[model samples]
Target: MRCAHCHEDNDLGLKPPPPKLQGVMRKGKMPSRAVATDQSVAQTVLAGKGKMPSFAGRFTEEQMRALIAYLRTDMPLPQQ
Candidate 1:
């Protein structure tokens, strides 16, 4: 939850609130993006878009996969 905590924290006062991750993969697009694929989602996470900060150089491929997996689950994300 290290990386994801920020995405979930509503109290961060982020200029544009982060989008909740649940079902984002199923929806098949990144938030506020018109044309995005799973690869594109990964790219966005790595590169950032708009107000969301880039995660580039922070996550290993395995970690990124796990994060994506967690976001894909139909079940509620576990509290950290």
Candidate 2:
């Protein structure tokens, strides 16, 4: 959630709030018009969605794993 586009507070009125990850993961809805999975979330991060920027080459697989794991735990993103 370090990315400005992913963090709602940082984005402000720039675009729609990035969907709530916990609910999206649990319910399979939001960011996209369909249900979400770890793989899909990773894809969204890598490819970008809506106003969110793409992180395609910015993170390693391990980093993506860490990010998904963190979201599944429903923990708040740490402050920079």
- The estimated TM-scores of all candidates read 0.76, 0.74
Error of 2 at 29 (Å): 2.2
Q: Write the per-residue lDDT of candidate 2 for residues 4-75, one digit (tens) a residue.
A: 345735556655556555545556664567557788888888988777788889999999998888777766
Give residue 8's error in model 2 in angstroms: 3.9
lDDT score of residue 61 within candidate 1: 94
Off by over 4 Å in 1: none
Provide the lDDT at 80 for model 1: 71
Query: Which residue pairs in model 1 clash with each other?
Result: none
lDDT for each residue of candidate 1 in 1-80, tens digit (9 for 90 to 100): 65446667655677676777677767776567544455777788898878778889999999888777776774555567
The parts of candidate 2 lying over 4 Å away from their true place are 4-6, 11-13
TM-score of 2: 0.74
Best by TM-score: 1
Estimate the overall C-alpha local distance difference test score of candidate 2. 0.69
